[model samples]
Target: MFTREWLRAVVVVMFTLAPMSVGAEVPWQFADNTRYMAMGDSLVAGYGAIPATQGYAYLLYKEGVFDKIPNTLLSNVGLIGATSQDVLDKQVPLAIDPFVPTVITLTVGGNDLASILTGADPATVLGNFQANLTNIFFQLRTALPEAKIYVSNLYDIPEIPMATEIVLLFNGIVEGVASGFQVPVADVFSAFEGRKGLRLIQRNGADQYEVHPSNAGHRAIAKAFKAVIENN
Candidate 1:
């Protein structure tokens, strides 16, 4: 015996309440105190971004991707030229001790692959990278079992010799290692796959084809990370 107007109001209320129910179903939620630690190589250090702050890690902190700035704490241990081994050695110890991050984002292995350019054998480089990455995850998971760890796969630099094939292999390793730890990976590889102006090396008439990401690239990387964090 409901009137038409009452039915319309009820329908509107149901639609409004439905969204809230869906939103509540999201597994992750913002915490009042979130300790976000960023660990990795040059990309995590914000190398190509004019100012290091423009790097994707900083952007995630500044934009409050994990939590509100006032509530969230950030510890960025990302170093330029840091290979996966460096992360396993230097960064991992720090993350375990003083920082004890509640959340972590890692981007590495690009520098490990860079060794192949210096006459290092490709098989050796990939093997070492895989071992190092596996250890990095294993250590982090052991030390910070509850921490939300997110890792990014390397992007492709098609201009470099054999870069595409190498990067594909690197990403495969990343995926496999991260899967073992139940860590989510931001698909930076796909984000920059066919994109232009993302790499500083791609700039017109650049003196050197640096592999670092440009500002636009950083934003894209941040976006990719954000998507994974929000969803998983």
Candidate 2:
């Protein structure tokens, strides 16, 4: 009953089927058939990746990583270069869709801080940024009541020594505002703090770090977001 040839065939079959079995058994938890919205600036726009088009949102959707409890219906409304005010004016409106129980993710405020840092007054600019962010989320809540909102705290971009303090200030405000909204906030600030000032290549191999993250950086952010989404 246990011939050598038969045993060899059995082992091959087992090896062939093992990966599928494991994948099938993995548990996935997130809503299905619901509309998903990605609202942010260049980070969500996926500035640095192979083919340069696979943002975290697209990656998660294509990989079926969050397709167990609820299938992912995604909309990417992130702009390549959008400030908080710009997102308020533009990105928020694009989230209008028919899908119920939608999930919205956003990252913003860096550009605003940059502008303010160059201006004469800092206090007023900081206050205005906070107010604008709060308003943006409020508008999102009003427009997408059936959706679950997720926002990312601004990434730390000051390790370059030129804007370190200003970046920390911006991130502090972002985190505080995100907390007030009671939404899941991905902490990209901490994840990128150590990597600041380091040159990360874009999909095109151009060295850029003033605003965009490398592929390795994006993966780190995506993993953090995945964890938070799972827990929520």
Candidate 3:
């Protein structure tokens, strides 16, 4: 059996590579009092990293044009350890508290896949992934009809040998759902694959299975938002 320590060590190998920018922009134009809401899982919640609000959602809010012009940027609705179904069931309702968010960001589905990986059942993982994608999008569309939603393409976590195929399967569902919904898909998968020395699993100085982005990875994701906003 692969010891817990051993599993984490192998996962660390996949993230050791560095990231390059695709430069995708945010689709919504910046406006006064423009509200932004981020709803998703640990990556959205800033897992393995303290001060979760310091994650990309807050970072992007800080860099946003509305922040400079007296806009109201609602706090990021990050639900730690939330699965996609959780987002459907929990986060979306909370998003409407302050007002309608003009912009939305989400990074979910990892927990669902991770759950399957832990159980060693790829078939079950794939089915849950497809269901989660449908539920996540359905909830997003239903809850925030006018919000420009950004659903991230799952990052490759082959760094954790226990679940690469599962990750790929989950990502496939995510991509197909994104296409169907007209939601902008941020492709973190393309950025992580084959990149050397990126280190996806870093927690403090050690590594683990929970995949959170480093400063560099967050910058790349932010760039994608910038690109989507500017071009679309």
What are the per-residue Cα lDDT tens digits for candidate 1 across 1-232? 2233443353243234222433443212333368788999889888899888899998998888988665565767788889888888888887787657799999998888888888899989999999998899899988889899999998899998889998998899999989988989999999998889999888887645488899999999999999999998
**Clash count, predicted structure 3:** 24
Q: Scored by Cα lDDT, where does model 2 land?
A: 0.63
Off by over 4 Å in 2: 1-32, 68-70, 97-101, 116-120, 195-209
Computed on alpha carbons, the lDDT of every model, listed in order, comes to 0.82, 0.63, 0.62
Q: How many backbone clashes does candidate 1 have?
A: 0
What pairs collide in candidate 1? none
True lDDT of residue 3, candidate 1: 35
Task: Indicate which candidate wins on TM-score.
Answer: 1
lDDT of 2 at 140: 72
Name model 3 segments beyond 4 Å from true.
1-32, 48-53, 65-69, 200-205, 208-210
lDDT tens readout by residue for model 3, 180-211: 88887777777766765444564455466657
Per-model TM values vs. the true structure: 0.85, 0.73, 0.74
Q: Give the total clashing residue pairs for model 2.
A: 3
Q: Sort the candidates on lDDT, descending order.
A: 1, 2, 3
Better of 1 and 3 by lDDT: 1
- Winner by lDDT between candidate 2 and candidate 1: 1
